[model samples]
Target: MDKRLIKRIAIALCVGPLLWVLFLFYCRPVVALHYSARATESIGFFFMIDYATRKQGMEPGETVVIPTPMFPERDLWILLSFPFDSKDSFEIRKPFSRVDVCIGAGAKVERTEIRHGFFDRFTEPREPCEPPTSKR
Candidate 1:
């Protein structure tokens, strides 16, 4: 083979695999394996019921109600046990009370109530203050 032809073929053989790898890293599906695994792990507990009460700095032992995410109409009340934790990956033992209620899409809150019980030790050990009502 000609020298120029041989040189060009060798360069293409080396560079072609590098370009294909670059394209796979940058242009392929953006989802990472770890992200997909994390999302899958959170499938059942995806819905959240974030809420607050109207009173400012309400002391503990006070009752407060928080709204829950939209759920099917089969059951009216949903008892939620929220495990409180400060960090993303930590053991959460404190239980927080939450209820599931129905409301319009634009409603501020989905009318719910707080359930108190022996689990209070887990749910509300100290003075319990609900979060400010959602503004929607």
Candidate 2:
């Protein structure tokens, strides 16, 4: 084998992945205010969008589960927990990892998971907040 060919092969293998990791880290923000996940919003770079949700009037140590706001599909499953209102941000490209994002202010975050068993995954999506009615 030629020395130049071997060196080029090694460089490509190392540099290719390094560039990819960098790209994922520095991607731009893609906002998702709605509670549903949309696949068409991803750019070539990783989904580095900022996501934030808050529920008011919650008890100090109550457990409330809201829909997982749109994150990079690249993640396997998001381990949701309290980031507290003061610290309300998580890494954009990481997946299948524990994210400590804000839930409610001065409220204790107990658990954040699907309210039911695995079958519940197929059920209708509901926002944690009650919708405004004309009468209210």
Candidate 3:
């Protein structure tokens, strides 16, 4: 094979993934989930996007941070629990936005807050999570 072509291929292979990683970090929004366990036993649930299960686990007081590609205005994300499952899924209206939800007993949303980034944690004006009704 040609030497120049091989060099070009190697460079492309290295740069392609680097660009993708940068895009994911800067463009894609992240989810800072905080599931509080009030029940005696740990709660098990499925973290889903558009009805497809992505992650399933039970973390009581610890915050579950997830970097997501779903857009707040475009897609629908939900949390569905087991054992006491409901017909309706608990919707995460603004996954892209900064929100930490407190799931109380019986898979209910206790509270929601729009927090600041890591650097701005101490800043004031902590907004509430109030996603607008989607057209769909």
Candidate 4:
């Protein structure tokens, strides 16, 4: 191999991983806390958006904190966009269902605070809700 080509290959191998790590450190996406509650009948884990904005199904016990993702690039756009760009600065992504996404958003998601209600009777799981498996 040409000596110059070999040097370029060596530099790339050394710098590639460093660049990737820096990218990861500098590009953290925004994620909000999601609380998953034990639904009635133990049917499945139920989660809500806009915490405390709704009154029903919250019950009064422990809630599983699920760190959910925001719109792609929206989380950082607010902090990086020009000061005059109000729309990009304050918009929040609407909530969607993605068990895997919430579980791995690199945020705290292990806390639980949802409890059983006085009139509600259901068997609570001994462990926190696991991320739903993709059927497809």
The lDDT values for all models are 0.29, 0.35, 0.55, 0.33
Q: How do the residues 53-82 of candidate 1 rate in per-residue lDDT, one tens digit apiece? A: 122111212223333222223333322222
Off-target runs (Cα >4 Å) in candidate 4 are 31-136
Per-candidate total of colliding backbone pairs: 11, 1, 0, 8
Clashing pairs in 3: none
**Candidate 2 lDDT, 7-110, residue by residue in tens:** 99999999999998775544322222222121222111112223443433333323323334334466433222223332333233443222222233322232
Write the residue-wise lDDT of candidate 3 on 14-123 in tens digits.
99999988865765444454555444445566667566676455556545655555344455655544534333245665533455565655555666666545433323
Considering every candidate listed, which one attains the maximal lDDT?
3
List the lowest-lDDT window of 10 residues for candidate 3.
120-129
Strongest candidate by TM-score: 3
Order by TM-score, highest first? 3, 2, 4, 1
lDDT of 4 by residue, 26-102 (tens): 43332222333422221122233333221222221233323333334333211111122112212234332222211
For all predictions, the C-alpha RMSD in Å is 20.3, 13.9, 10.1, 16.3
Q: What TM-score, over all chains together, does every model reach?
A: 0.25, 0.26, 0.52, 0.25
How far out, in Å, is residue 80 in model 3? Answer: 4.4
